[model samples]
Target: MKMFGLRLLLTVFLLVLLELLVINIAGILPFIASHKANISDAPYMEFITDNLQHPIESSTHMIEEKNPLFFLGSGAVVLFTIYATFFMKGGKGKYELADKYGVHGSSRFAQRHEIFKQGETVGVPAKQLMKDLEASMLVSKGEK
Candidate 1:
């Protein structure tokens, strides 16, 4: 439970970092335009200059194309963070867990439907698959 909480915290921090990355990307000056926008403006004309977002101009963008290793590494980290965060032991289909911790039936109902589907696709015996499907369906009924 403590581990899951920490993982959740890290996931949120990563998301905030991703948002900063997006803002930096948005700050990048356009090299070309659709011809509708004036290209030869105050900067090119000289004497006068204006930036769309001067504050943004200070931040440099990560060049993913030029740095494939960095891109792949960061992407893997982000993906792993996401997987560790919301892949709940908490709830499914409508029946939510009470403790919502990483224990007991905050333990038992852990992704039953998804697990059943994966097992079925991987050729787990049909009888086992059926049992899993039924169990998931039964719990999802929320009748207790």
Candidate 2:
């Protein structure tokens, strides 16, 4: 299971990395190619064009080139991938973050019909009451 999760994470990360590379390359190609004639003349534009034209060198290194938006977008992808790779897993158990705080647990509910049969309140089963500490505490505290 752990291996599968790791594979899935790696697959997603690679796909995103590829997507960012493709988009960056595609997006800057036109700008650089269109301005190629004058790119060599403008020092700042040449620098910007070169930076934008390069692929991401490493996970920590990013070349925004000319499109800051695409650079930021790629950064977002990297952040999300890192976060998911470290934190997410494939299972309903992953959604149990709420359980960590004790928001959910064993619980029992009495049917309304069962509770008010013939217009009289029926006592809930003791086992169900014990599942809820509030009910048990109420009974015990009353005696004290």
Candidate 3:
């Protein structure tokens, strides 16, 4: 769980970095382009200094003027991070079951249903099966 949390944090960091890169590029591209005809001729250091001195002021107007795509990109990144962090399953047990029983499916619900069916087939009571499943999951996760 600690490892997973670390990984999640890293993933979120990378996503935010990507969003910032996109937004910054969108915000600064026009200013940079208009400053000079050639890329090499642009006042790169001065632009950086100005932005550093007034980061929000420098980017706000440009961001406001640009199309909604920049905001959409940020929103998409946030949504993706949320989905990945909270909704995604690690599925170690599912993969273990698949390898053991040859069951195949990507859906977590179907995978769990198949496990329940297998437990029933093996004469395990539903209540006991659920307990066993929970125990196994905890053990697999190193929480028990």
Question: Top lDDT: which candidate number?
Answer: 3
**How many steric clashes does model 2 contain?**
1
Using lDDT as the measure, what is the rank order of every candidate, best first?
Answer: 3, 2, 1
Candidate 3, residue 45: the lDDT equals 71
Q: Which ten residues in a row have the lowest lDDT in candidate 1?
A: 44-53
Error of 2 at 124 (Å): 26
Instruction: Evaluate candidate 1 by giving its C-alpha RMSD to the native, one decimal.
Output: 19.8
Q: Please provide TM-scores, in order, for all candidate models, with all chains considered together.
A: 0.26, 0.31, 0.42
- Each model's lDDT comes to 0.51, 0.59, 0.68
In candidate 1, position 62 carries an lDDT of: 33
Q: State the lDDT of candidate 2 residue by residue for 82-133, as single tens digits.
A: 6666677656674455533333462445455545678576577987867776
Model 3 lDDT per residue over 1-144, tens place = 999899778887877666656555555667665765677877777766675566567547656676465667667878887787677896677557653455446334445655667546667699999999999999999997
Candidate 1 lDDT, tens digit per residue, 1-144?
Answer: 998798778878876566445433432333223322766552432211222243234233335234444355457657756775776454363335343434443545545564557546566799999999998988899754
Question: Which is superior by lDDT, 1 or 2?
Answer: 2
Give the candidate number with the greatest TM-score.
3
**Model 3: number of backbone collisions:** 0
Regarding TM-score, does 1 or 3 come out ahead?
3
